[model samples]
Target: MPKVISNTSPILYLYRIGGIQWFSKLFDEVWVPEAVKNELRAGKIQGYDVPNPADYSWITIVNPKSMPSEWLALDLGIGEIAAMAGN
Candidate 1:
């Protein structure tokens, strides 16, 4: 089983430092919240980052499901919550 909880900042920061390979080496897979993926793909023409196909492999991109919330609140855009609450 892979670690299904990852935040956008660590992912992005690792990408910037060319350590995404390290992440792949450590974990069989990673999880990205919809909000996190949105943050990753936010800018147009952002060019290739470290996690790009050319740089690393085995890191699959996925849109993790949202949690159940009765009360309408500001979304924090998290991954652990996604993995815990998701299928």
Candidate 2:
């Protein structure tokens, strides 16, 4: 089993279609940043019907300290920043 760090979009899409189980089968665990978790929660509130990412036991959410200033300078969304920097 392999461990993988994941971004928001892929997780969102997979959860939207109810395929989140694939992560468990493929990897020992899939790590996500707090930002990604927030994104999913927001999407659900916005009526996107996204599944709760936390419901998946294989998905671990992390809060990384000190994101790269360069990535932050890119003015990307929190999810993107977290994905690149959290890793």
Candidate 3:
């Protein structure tokens, strides 16, 4: 399977619906930026069924080296910034 980079919303919904395993079935590994993981943490606090992102073996958290000023200028959330910046 090819590498899979994911944003936050899809993950949030999938986790809430108990369909997170679909990620594993579709991809050998899933790469999410640190921002995505942070969003997941926020979801967990909101009583969503978000698993601890670090506990998943197939899910890798990557920190973006740099974020473009242009992307930041868009005023998007961290998860959007990370995904757009190719984190």
Best candidate according to lDDT: 3
lDDT of 3 by residue, 2-81 (tens): 77878897777887788987898999878889999998898788986777778878899898888888887786788978
| TM-score to native of every candidate shown | 0.59, 0.87, 0.82
Q: Which candidate is the best by TM-score?
A: 2
Task: State the TM-score for model 3.
Answer: 0.82
TM-score of 2: 0.87
Residue 67 lDDT (model 2): 85
For model 2, the stretches where C-alpha displacement exceeds 4 angstroms are none
Candidate 2 lDDT by residue in tens digits, 1-87: 888888788887887787878888999978899898898899888888776767887788988777867776786888888877765
By summed lDDT, the worst window of 10 consecutive residues in model 3 runs over 47-56
